[model samples]
Target: MTTTLHCHMPLPANFRADGFLDFHRRDAQQVAERVYEQTLEKGLLWHGQPALLRIALQPQQAEASLLLDGASRRDDEALLASTVRHMLGLTQPVEAFEAVVAGHPQLGPLLARQSGLRVPQTSSGFEALAWAIIGQQISVAAAVSIRRRFIQAAGRRHSSGLYCLPDADCAAGMDEASLRAAGFTQGKAQTLLRLAAIVASGELPLAAWQFAPDAAQIGKQLAAIRGIGPWTISYALLRGFAWLDGSLHGDVAVRRNLQRLLARDDKLEAAEVEAWLAPFSPWRALVAAHLWAMQSSDGY
Candidate 1:
C-alpha cells in the first residue's frame, strides 16, 4: 500500500536559497521546477524500499516542506523526516561554524556573504561513495554526465518517473563492463563494484555510521578498500553520514578557491591546503563548502 506524509522543517539562520537552488538545478536525480518557490523532486530508497521525496523551498519564509510519497509504513514518518533533514542539511550547525569563522581576516567576509549555505548530502552512503569514486580527478560536468549514465544503467525507475539511485545490492549486481560502458575508468569501475559488494554483504556497515558516527573507524574500514583514499573517504563521510570534520583539502575546487581567497599567485600543495584547513577542525567540511560557494557565487 502507498502512504503519503508531510513534514515541515525550519531553515537555518540567514538561509540563502542560492546553494539549494543551484543544487536543485544541477542535480541529475531531480526534476526541474521554478516559480514563486523552487521544488526538488527525486526518487530514493527508504530501508530498501522506493519512495519519492519532494522538497519545496520558500526562501522568503526561511522554511521548507518535505513530502514523502509511496512509503510502505506509516511508522516510518519520523525516520523519513530525519532522512530528509540529513539530505537537505537542515541540521547543520551553521551558526557554530560561523562563530568559529567570525572576525577571521579571509573567511569572515566570505562567511558573511554566504551566511546560510550548507552542503547538500547524498541520499545514502553508497551513493556518496560511488559518486566520490566516479568524480576522482574529473571535472564536475564530466562527473555529472557519467553519473547520469550510471544511474540509468544501475538505478530503478519510480512511479514519479524519476530514477532512484541504486541501493548497495542493486549496485553490487552491476558488472564492471557495464560501469565501463557508462564512462567509468577501469579502476573506478572496479572500485565501485567492490564497494557495492562489501556494503551489500553487510561487511562495511555504512548505515550504522549515520546513527552513531565513528569517523576514524569508518575511515579505516573504507581505506582498506582499493581505490578508496583520503579524499574519497572524507567526501563520503561529509555527504553520506553528515560527519562534518573530514578534511577536503584534496578537492580541486577547494584548493583553487582557497588560492583565490588568499590571492596567491602560485598553485598550492595538497599538504599546504591540509595544513590550512586543520585549524577549522570539526568544521573543515563546512569550510570547504564555503570555499565551493565562493567559487560558485558571482560578484564575490
Candidate 2:
C-alpha cells in the first residue's frame, strides 16, 4: 500500500534552497539525499513507523509529500507537516532577522552574500542531541564517519532502504557496547545512553522544549546531564529544537571563522565571541550560522 500526504508551507523571500540541500549532502550516511539542488528526499521514523519525505523547493514555498506504508491519522499528518516545516527552516523568522541585522557593519555584507540562509533542524530532538554527543572533540570528517556507523548500528531502515537515526526510545534500548562498536568513545557512548534514557522516560521533556517559553529552564535541564555542556546544548537547541537564541560562541568553527572574518591576528577567546554576539540577542544563533557559512567565497 502506498500512503502519501502532500503539504506546502510559505517560505521566506530570501530562502535559499542550497543552504538546506547542501547540508544533507555533507555525508554519505545514505539517510537523506539531495536529488538536485532544489529537491530532497529523506527517510525517517515517525512515531516508530517508517516514512519517506520528498520536498520540492520554490522561491515562495516548499511542497512536500510524506510517504508511509500505512494510513495516517489527521493529527499524524498535521504533525508530519509541522516537522517538515521545521526541518526546512520554514518556521524561522528570516525576514525579521535580516531586517534587524541590515545595519550591522560586520554582518550586513555577510548576510548580503549568504542571504536566505536558515539553520536547519533535525527530525527530532533526540537525534540532534545524539549527533552532538557523537560529534564532540572530533573533526567533521571523523564525526561523519562515526555517525554513519552509529546509524547503521542502531537506526531503523525504511522501506526505501534508507536508515533513520534512532529516536530516544530506540536509543534507550541500545547498549553501550553497541555504540562502542560503532566507533563512539566510551564516554560518549555512556553519555548518549544516559541522555536517551532520560528523554525516553520523559524526565527531560526534550521533545516539547521547542514550544516551551522558558529557554533557560530547558538549558538548565540539558546542562544537568553529564558530558553535555554549553556547546552541546546550544548546538542541540539550534539543530533539534529550532531555538535560535542559544549562544554557540564555544564552537571552534564559529571562533575560527570569526577571526578570519575580522582578519584578526590573534585567536578569539570565548568571552570575546560572546561579547561580540551579545547585541544580536534572539538571533545570535542565526549570526553564528552566518559566521559558520563565511569562507573565501564570502570575500572574508
Candidate 3:
C-alpha cells in the first residue's frame, strides 16, 4: 500500500525519507541474496530483497507502505509504520526544543538560522567508527562510492538498494586481501579491522557514544581510536547518528558552504567557522543540515 499522512495542523519543519535506507549497503544489488542485515529490518528478506518504504511523518500522524515486489505484506506494512514512528522524532519534534537552547552564548547564531533539529537514535558505535574510517580525506560522493563497495561486500541483502552494514563478525571474517580487493587501501583496511576489533571485543562502548556528556567527552571517545580524528569523529557524530550540535569544519564541503554563507576569503580558518557557531550550540547540526539542504535544493 502507498501511504500518505496529513499534517498535524502545525506541520513539522522537516521529514526523513529513507529512514531505513541508511542501513542499506550502498552496493548489495550485485552479489548475494543473504548479505548483512540492518537494525530496522524485520529479517534478511520478506522474499529475499531489501525493503523500500515511503513514509511521511508529521507530528500528528505518520503513514508508511511497502509493496514487496508487487505483493503487499501486512507485516511489512506494520513494520514500516512502527519504524517510521520511532525514527521521525514525531513524539517531541525536538528541533523546537533545541531552538530554545540555540540562543545560548555558545550556540547563538547557528541556532538563529536553523529551523529544525530532528534527532533519531539509530547508529551503533561500531557503525560510526567504520563510517569515520571510510570518510577520511575524501569527497562525500567518493566516500559514498567506497561505502557502497564496503557495504555490499559485508552487507546482508533485504530488498532493492538496501542491506545491512557489516558487523564485527561479518567484517572480521574477511581477510585483509579481500578488503583490499574491494578498494580499501591498506591503511584504511587496517583501520577498519582495528575498529571492528575494538567494537567486537568490547574495548569501545560505541553503543553509548551518542549519549556522551559533552563535545569534549565525545571528542575524547572518538579520538581515542587510532584512525578516528576530530574531523572524522565529528562527522560521524553529526551524520552517522543525529548529534545535532556536532559541526564539521574540516569538511571541505561544509567549509566551502561556510565561505559562501559568510562571503569570505578561501583561507577562512575552520576555527573561525566554528566560532561563528557560538550562538548555535547544540543546534548547530540543524544549521549544518539546512546548509546541506540548500546545496542539494533544486538539484543545484
Candidate 4:
C-alpha cells in the first residue's frame, strides 16, 4: 500500500530555499538525495516509523511543502512537522540575527546576499555525531565519500532508494573490519563504535544534551567521548541541536572566512577568533552561517 502525507510550512521572510539546499547538498552527496531545482529526499525515523520525506520549495512564495511518502499513521503528522521544522530551522526567527548583522559592517552585507539562509540540522544527534566523527581531519569531499560508504553498509534501506541513517544500535553493532572497509581508519572506526556503544547503552545521553544549561556542559559531555574534540562538539551543537549560541571559532572554514572578511594575511588563532566573536554573543552561530555562506562561491 502507498501512503502519502502532505504539509505546508511557512518560511521566514529571509529564508532562502536555494541556500539551504546548497548547504545540504554540499556534504550530503552520498548520504542524501537532493535534486537541485526540484526536491530533496531523505529517510527519517519518525515515531517508530521509517518515513521517506520529500520537500520542495514553492517558488516566489514564503512557504514550502513537505511530502511524506512512507508515513502511514495520521498521528505522526505532528512529529513529522516538528522534524521538518527542526531540520530546516523554520521555528527560529531570523530578525534577531539580522539585527546583530546590522551592527557588524563585515557581516551585514552577507545578510542581503544570502537572505534566507538557515543552518540545516541533521535528522538526529546520532547522525550528527556520525558525520562529525567521519569528517575529523579529512577534507569535506573525502569525508562525504566515506560517509556514503558507511551509510550504505549500516543505514536502513528504503524502497525509494534512500537510506535512513543508522541508529545507535546499528552503529554500535558494527565491527572494526566492516567500518574500516567503509573507508574509516582504524582509529576513527574504533571511535565511531565506541561512541555508538555509549549512546546505545545509555552511558552517553545524546538527546539529553539539549536540556543542558549551557553549551559548555554539552561540550564537556561530548568531549568525554573517545574521539570527539572541541571542534566536533561545537559543530554538532550548531548543526545537530540548532543551538544559536554555538560558535565555530575552532573550525578551519570559519577561521579562513574570518581572515578573508578581515582582509588579513595571517591566520587567526582560536583565541583570536573567540575574542573577535565575543561581540556577537548569542548570535555567533548566525555569524558562522554567514561566514559559511560567503564561502559558497569557493565551495564549503
Candidate 5:
C-alpha cells in the first residue's frame, strides 16, 4: 500500500533551495534527483516501508513544502519531517553567520552572490565517511564515478530504481575483490574495509559522536583510524555531523578557492588559511561552503 503526507517547514530569511540543490547535483550519480520540479529522494523509508520524499521550495519564501509518498502513521510523518529538516539544514539560524559576513569586505560580496547557500548533508555517516575515503586525492568527477560503481556493487536496491548507500554492515561484508572490481585501488579498498569494520563493530559510535561537545577531540579519534586524516575527519564532521565549527583548511579545493577568493598568486598553507579564518570561528564550515559555492559559480 502507498500513502502520502505533507509538512511545511519554516525557513530563515535568506534560504535558497536552488543554490543548495545546485551544489548537491554536482554528484551526477547521486541517488536523489530533480523530479517533477522538486528535489526527490527515491528510497527514503518511513517505518520500514519504502517512501519517496519530494522537497519543494520557493526562493525567499518563509516555508518549504515536504511531500512524502509512502508515509502513513504520525510517527512516520515525524521521522520524515526530521530527516527533511536535517538534510536541508533548515534548523540552523544563519543570522549570526550573516552578521559576521556582512562585516567582512571580501566575504560580503561572495555572500551577496550566494545569499542562501547551506552545507548539504550526506544521507548517512557511513556514506559520508566512505565518500571521504573514495574522494581522497582524486578529481570530483572521478570520485563520483567510482562512488557510483561502489554503490551499485554494495548498496541495496529499491523498487524505484534508486540504490540506498551501503551501511556499515554491507560495506564490511564486501570482499576485497568486489571492491577492486568497483574501481577501488588496493590500498583504498583496504582502508575502506578497515573503516567499515570499525563502524560495524560499534567501536567508533559515530551517531553518538555527532552530539559530542568537542569536535576537535572527535577529529582526533577519527584521525587515529587508518586512512582518515585531518581533511577526511573535517569533511565528515561538516557533512555528516552538521558541525558548523569544523574548518576545511586541509581540503585542497577549499585552499584553492580561498586563494582565488583573496586574489593571491601563491598558495596559502593550512596554518595561514586557519589564521585567516579565525574571525569566522564557529562558522568556518559555512565559509568553506561559500568558497565551494564560489567555485561552482565560476564553473570550476
Candidate 6:
C-alpha cells in the first residue's frame, strides 16, 4: 500500500550508513539501506524496521505513497504520517541543526559529510547500556557477534525487520547458560541478565533518562549500574542520544584520530584530545561522527 504524503521536515544533515549501523541495529546485515533519525531526542533513536524503508522517498517528486509496516504496521494513517514526518526530519527546524554544526571546524566538515543529522529521540537506553557491557574490551566484530546472539534469544522480531528489544520481563529469566551459547562470558552474561532483572523490577529505570545532563551526572548515573560506566555512558550518548558533541574521554580511536589529525604520534593522550576538541563544544558529537566516519572509510 502506497500513500502520498508531504514532508514538513528538511532532509537531515547527518544521514549515512557507513557501517556504524552494522553495529547499532539488529536488521543491519539484510536491511540497512534505509535507517535515519532526527537530532531532537539525540541520536539514540533509530529506524530499524523494514517498513520504515518500504516506501522509498521520492526525492525529486517530493511526493509519493508511504509504505508503512514493521513495528508500526498497526498504526493509523495519522500516526504513520507523523512517523514519516519525524523520520524525514519534517517536524524539527533545520535551523537547529545548522546552529549545532555552524561554527566548529571539525563538526562543520562532519555535518557536511553526514548529509542531514536529524535523529528522533526514542532509544532503549538500557539496551544500549547492555550493548556497552557486551562490547567492552572486545573488537567491534566480536561485540556484534555476541550482541546478535543475545538479541536473537531475547528479542522478538517485529515486522519490517525491527526487533523491539526485550523488556525486563523477557530478560529477567535469561540465565547464564543461554547467554553462553550467544558467546557471552559467564561474567558478562550474568551482568546482562541481572541488569534486565533490575529493569523488569523497576529498580532501574534504564529506558527513562534525559539528554541534558552535565558530564558528571551522566557518568555518575550510568556508573551506578553494575555493567555500565563512563565509557558506557559516553557510548550511550553516541548510540542512544546521537550527541553532536559527544566524545569519550578515553576512547582509543578518538585519541588516535586526534593524534593523526594533528601529525602527532599514534599514542596521543586522551586529555590532549579532549583539550583540542573542547572548542567544538555542543557539537563534539558531530566531530566524533566525522572522525569515526573518516576511519570508517579509509582506515587512516
lDDT winner: 2
Pick by TM-score: which candidate is best? 2
What lDDT tens digits, residue by residue, belong to model 6 across residues 1-300? 323223333333344322323233433443223334311111111233322222233333122233333233343455445444533334434357566656755555555555544432223556556777787777666776776677677655534454445545666777888889989988888777877777677765544443333545556655676766566677766555444456565666667676665666558787877787787666555456456555652211
lDDT of 3 by residue, 112-218 (tens): 54445344433344555566677788755566667667766775654454555566656766677767877778998987887777666756655444334255666
Q: Name the candidate, 1 or 3, with the larger lDDT value.
A: 1
Better of 1 and 5 by lDDT: 1
Tens-digit per-residue lDDT, 1-300, candidate 1: 566677767765566666666754554444322223566666666666666767777644333333344445655667667767787787788888888789999999998888878778776788889888988888877887788888889757666667777889888898999999999999999999999999999999987677557889999999999999999999989888888898988888899899999999999888999999999998998898888887773211
**Mind giving the per-residue lDDT tens digits that candidate 4 earns over 110-179?**
6777766777777777888788889887777888888888877876765676766677877888899989
lDDT of 1 at 33: 26
Residue 127 lDDT in model 3?
59
Greater-TM-score candidate between 2 and 3: 2
lDDT of 5 by residue, 219-248 (tens): 777888877887787778877777887778
Task: Estimate the TM-score of every prediction.
Answer: 0.90, 0.93, 0.65, 0.87, 0.84, 0.66
Off by over 4 Å in 1: 27-37, 59-71, 297-300
lDDT of each: 0.77, 0.81, 0.53, 0.72, 0.71, 0.52
Off by over 4 Å in 2: 32-34, 211-213, 296-300
Residue pair clashes in candidate 2: none
Model 4 segments beyond 4 Å from truth? 1-3, 27-31, 47-49, 60-75, 207-217, 297-300
Ranked by TM-score from best down, the candidates are: 2, 1, 4, 5, 6, 3
Model 6 — TM-score against the truth? 0.66
Cα lDDT over the full model 2: 0.81
Worst 10 residues of 5 by lDDT: 61-70
* TM-score, model 4 to reference: 0.87
Model 6 lDDT-worst window of ten: 38-47
Q: Which residue window of length 10 is worst by lDDT in model 2?
A: 291-300
